[model samples]
Target: MRSPAPEREGDDTLVWNVACPTRPSSVPGVAMAGFSDRGRLPEGQRLIPHPAVTLVLDFGPAPPVVDAADGRRHRGSLVAGLGLGGALWARGDDLACVQVRLSPVTAGAALGVRPDELEGAVVPLDALWGRDAARIGERLGEAASWEERFALTDALLARRCAAATPANAVDPEVNRAWDRLVASRGRARVERLADEVGWSRKRLWSRFRAQVGMGPKRAAKLVRFDHAAHRLAAGHDTARVAAEGGYTDQSHLHRDVVAFTGVTPTGVARASFLTVDETAWPTLPLGGVNAGKTV
Candidate 1:
């Protein structure tokens, strides 16, 4: 029931261990509620990639802005931010939950949905499961551990795959652009992307909006930020994160961190067990922060 905090007093980083609920105990391996403290993620100069499947539930009075580019808002007490080709942060909740990180293409194919079109939709997690919210809620309320919750999540994903249709397949162009953006992060310009994809800016924009729910530039930025965030979380210094991510300087990194998650670099890097994905390393510059910290 408690949310994760950014950091505790006397320390810079905070990690909350969330319990998985298990009363109706059917789904398995997923927590009923999880949240993270509204801490800032470090700034990086590079573009990041999105996690494959992210389930977000906001225990708030209103639907928060899930993505600035799509302008999609969610009012339901519980919503899912499933990323086919993007990253998302809850500017509202200090949260924690079991998120099954998968490859976008693999997850999409397995779910029978085009990874592109699912970019910014905040559909109910249970809706995707074809089960009533309370039914799933009961399962979560009874779940015992993170592993159990993950198992339940895998089952739910399987069910979703069975129910999917061709209508769910996203546009191929969207995937093409998404792949390029992921590969380049924020380093690639829109004009260059347009040329590579053989589409006018207008054409790309239309396709992007329809398939990915945002322009290529915004999506690229979010993806890039995710990569930088991973680096910061992994103990990379600020300057290094910025430079590697393609930022002009530490200020640029700071601005991006504040703009995306409303948190600062030092705040996120406080955690001692942060893990960095190597592919995302370029987003952070080397030897950027705490180079002088006394060992």
Candidate 2:
């Protein structure tokens, strides 16, 4: 899949060769995509935040570098938490990597860490996975094709899930609440979610935050923003998108678009990060359990 060439001056014209696995992963809630740059990578490519944990395994000749709004720089393989609010920029050349998106419901088990620990943060994979991180990078670099890389990644994630301890398990109630929120596209009420889960509002909020890395309300907003951003990218008018996307008014939608992405709705409509989805991940569910499910 090819993204439109970036508009910035002096940036390379990037053409990405995107590949998807021939079959679904054995592990649920895990999705992967492979991207190889046909030319030098675009400079300072902004990344729009989504509502799922992201893991990038870089095995290109040169490692990619990500710069955060806070002025921190991360290189090579890394994991980014949900809801970063469009504060990250990726810059590199000769990029080749398999990107994985993990649903919050299963991220803890697959990552061997509480999702909450990663909120709004990007960490080097080796920091969490130790020597195994380096080993996987080496193996991925040695793989002969994208298909082999996908298979290797799926096997690694499955092993991690299988080895997760009880402590990494998410509560069934939390899972249910997440499902409802996704199904509603973040239009679901928190009080109603609490009641449905048979828990008080306070209890539900605490548990969801602890297990999912953010409060229920924040998660809902992120999910809602994700939906609206895509519609805008599809060329829908802002007023119509606001009306049907659970916003009280066009202004409300504008605020959200700016809040989550640090850009106006118009700007977001043109974002390469979002526009690329049409081809790179045409069939993926954005924020659900099986999100990022490529062809």
Candidate 3:
């Protein structure tokens, strides 16, 4: 049987209110979700903690080449972006209006993609799955209408999962290093990490590519930068943020802030709700809480 799910929209962003379909009864989870946003080159692209399974409803215009796990650029068909809960690094004027967002575990299981492979990995939207562009459009067109999208989403997810491949796991060393950086809010050294992991720089880089989807140094920078952003959002001074996040100085932090988010710390804090989705943007409340559920 089908159910009615609430829908919400915004200037460049829209989120549908829905319950997580497959989450544990006691453990909070997110069911299938839908989102549509017009892409604008926002400051730095950020990463999310959990992975996602997404479907591109339609690419309004031209396609964009996003960074991939292998660091290779893959050209996609959709004038849209679809990302699973993986690491993404973006620094360009790529734009699109996209749809579909799913919880990490549900998405991974439904799509047959592993959770760890998505950690810190970024691939062109199309690289992960090659679907008939027209078919994808058809699904989106139907799903966007009324609440039927949920059922359509279910079928679509099932199909994708049926044809999907098993995802690989992230490297232990690379993951450990990433965890430390994230826990420290972006403070650590590759040399020290390498010594702890007992892997050479070359080996570490390779592992990062395979597991985390980025090089160690780049990932570290992102971790530190992400921490800086959270600090700024939470009302930290620019200089203090720089010092705490391990930047050489406030100027460096400022540059990174501009380079990554296209806004100053104060600017980020000033806004009530953020617009551009920082690919790896950190959220407050320590862990994370699932919001909005209907009785």
Candidate 4:
């Protein structure tokens, strides 16, 4: 069967949709996207947040200039850390990129940088993977087709992961905490997680923060908010989604949406950047990982 193509191209964005990658099982949590801006991109920024860490590679005439809330404008292929209520303002001309999402546990190994090191930051891939990042960018840009690019990326990550040492591994307890958070759809209690892991709350907080980049509570909140946002996009009513997502009320949901994306729930539901998730990342279910497995 043929892979899917972009649904539509507008004056601002040109997206080339491809089939999900079928590669080594070592990296089931990975997903890929290929897209470009049609000639000229419109003004304004987009707030992008997901359960997994984001890696982007630029190959078009103009690479994306993604300005995060901290006022840092990062260019070229880069890794976007887990955003905790962070908004990224992006703008460029003739922009194209292949965006990858790796389960946070595997992300650190493939990028050779711990997740905590990327908290609240958007960094150039060169800063993390150095020469390897440069080589990957060149190879991806030179690939003849979308399928080839996706395959190349998957193989590269899988190889890197296989060769990584124990230093790159996450703490088993911390890894479990993350899995529970995702499985619970961010509803897992931090205290319960601490007990489950046989650690005190403070210890759990310190370790998880150092490994996952965000404290357990914040990670849960981010995961829960992501679920609610996608549900809103799926055309659910605001009140129903809020209640189902465990929000105290519609107002609480509104506050979170505003906090995370700097926009109303309705605006989040209409976000094209988010609307593409289903098509571009078919295998990436909610929680963004296989809970039972580590990395």
TM-score of each: 0.56, 0.91, 0.50, 0.88
lDDT of every predicted structure (CA atoms): 0.47, 0.80, 0.45, 0.74
Please report the candidate that would top lDDT against the real structure.
Answer: 2
CA RMSD for every model? 10.2, 3.4, 8.8, 2.8
- Index of the highest-TM-score prediction: 2
**CA lDDT of 224 in candidate 1?**
67
Pairs of residues clashing in candidate 4: none
**Which residue segments of model 2 deviate by more than 4 Å?**
1-14, 40-42, 287-295
**Candidate 3 residue-wise lDDT, 75-129, digit = tens:** 4332111122233333233333233444333344343454345543443444455
What's the lDDT for candidate 4?
A: 0.74
**Residue ranges of candidate 3 with Cα displaced over 4 Å:** 1-33, 36-130, 144-169, 261-295
Writing each residue's lDDT as its tens digit, candidate 2 over 1-295 gives: 2333354666343356677777767887777788877665556577788888888999999888898756789999988887652558887889888988787888889999878998768889999999999899999999998889999999999999999999888898898888787778889987799999999999999999999899999989988988898888788999999999999999999998888878899988877666566555544655322432221
Candidate 4 structure quality by residue, lDDT tens digits, 103-158: 67667777777778887588888887778777887887898877687778778888
- Return whichever of 1 and 3 wins on TM-score: 1
- Lowest summed lDDT window (length 10), candidate 2: 286-295
CA displacement after TM-score superposition, residue 87 of candidate 2 (Å): 3.3
TM-score of 3: 0.50
